[model samples]
Target: MATAIRRLLTAAVLLAAAAAAPARAGTLPPLVDVAWLEARLGDPALLILDVRGPLDGEDVVPFERAHIPGSVHTDYLKDGWRTTVEGVPFVLPPVDRLEVLLGDLGIDETRTVVVVPYGSTSTGFGTAARVYWTLRVLGHDAVTILDGGFLTWRADPARPVETGPSVPEPALFEAKPRLDWVVDTREVERALRDDAALLVDARPEDQYAGRTVKPGVQAAGHIPGALNLPESVFFVPGSGRLKPVRELAALVPGTVRGFAGPIITYCNTGHWAATLWFVMHELLGMEDVRLYDASMVGWAADPKRPVERAVPASG
Candidate 1:
């Protein structure tokens, strides 16, 4: 073969290989039952992470003093997964920095991470969902939330508990940003106007209405015509689990009626948004759900957008 022809053939082979390979899409692992996790506790590929933090200024370390054995401690607050960009709260760190941090935490491409938050459910436990969001956006396909979080783990006396940190060998996990997992202000603005997508605001009634909002929001109300199912509703105190799937299915607006358009879940700074996304993507089995990582912090920063809230939304 001619030299030029040989080079062309090589280039074609490379192109074909690239096209034929799987696109490396992310996977949303289900919320595991206690039995499921207990069964998998001894799996070599699994790592349990505790994401509990101080509640109402109480020291979190004390709680960690008695926690599930074989669990690694990770503080979503002080560990520096976020930074303040123009005062938008807790923005995700750059991919390179995140990759290093995950490695230090003993998480890697091959690990199946299970994160447990401070609470059994969503009472001030948005941090767990936030960390879950971080893992998902970083192209991890094997992350699961410990069903009902730490509270459930605590309730069962037989479940093993230990004090302090559990360390592991530093790992080498490479995280490529999956931008599709997240939506930005532009996409949100379009979702607000578009007839297809649903924009679910996970903020409280006060924030949703014009009563009170966190600082720096452009306007006091919700995105022009967004649905309001504040994150709190999803947390059922009785079960320690998220609301029953049937209850949630009926509660979630767009899912029941065959309206499976894209969902963009958002809250003040994306923390609560993660909870909403978790409920939809994991519990309710809603498809094509995405998070606005910047969330209201980015949306409300702009003057062009309109916030409108009048009626209280219910099931």
Candidate 2:
């Protein structure tokens, strides 16, 4: 049909653009602005992965409607990006499956991937952080997150937008999982017992104080000895962009800011924790930070695990 032919032609054009794109010179930063991305739109080594989905009531923008030219669309929430492991939701999937998913998206070790989120709320921005964390865990260091995300890109009407889904030219992607980047429940338990790592609870104050609990999590409070540092504080008010380093440092509590040990971030699931991990590990250059991928959902599933309830210090 005509429609099918048009799609094929569009794919051909995108592939051609990618093929002709110039090789990028240096390592890509962990975060890139709209201007930075626009300048390298057609880079063959760059993969613009639009991970827009319904996070925090933001409606999904169909790829057929508008997207960055030569970009591929992948729903971060609905996709197999996260899987349930041992009844713990939002856990990272096995390495083999991740390899298939990335390979299908035409992502490989050589490609510098840019994850694009909806850029409406902190929760939405977390989606990008989660994906960015996943890539790093898979030993793919050539990944970056788009600051201000897709909304920032659309803010200027002059910016080019492409319609219809981009057909990716599949490449073989191999996974080299970084076991140290993620910690399991037993590791967390050991850390709690030995006080080896700084447990930073990323849930809101209410949740940390046992005032509210996320529905699948059996517990009503955070883990023992964990300090509450809500993920929202890391972002600019009413925006997806993260606050400047100085502003972020000012917001961080003295306990966390002064600590010089291994840090672990956790939330209801690993979703919000990824944001904290990105901030600490990627932004703050803290090398020893790890993500509790199973987080509270997995920890609380066992009633034997001690959950602490305490009033967080007034800011």
CA lDDT, every prediction?
0.72, 0.84
Off by over 4 Å in 1: 1-29, 55-63, 120-123, 193-196, 215-218, 238-240, 254-257, 312-315
Stretches of candidate 2 off by over 4 Å are 1-26, 312-315
Provide backbone clash counts, one per model.
Answer: 0, 0
Which has the greatest lDDT? 2
Native-referenced Cα lDDT, model 2: 0.84
Give the clash count for model 2. 0
lDDT of 2 at 187: 96
- TM-score of every candidate: 0.81, 0.89
Q: Model 1, 169-204: lDDT tens per residue?
A: 799989877778788777777766667587788988
The residue-by-residue lDDT of candidate 2 on 16-47, one tens digit each, is 32332222213566778999999999999999
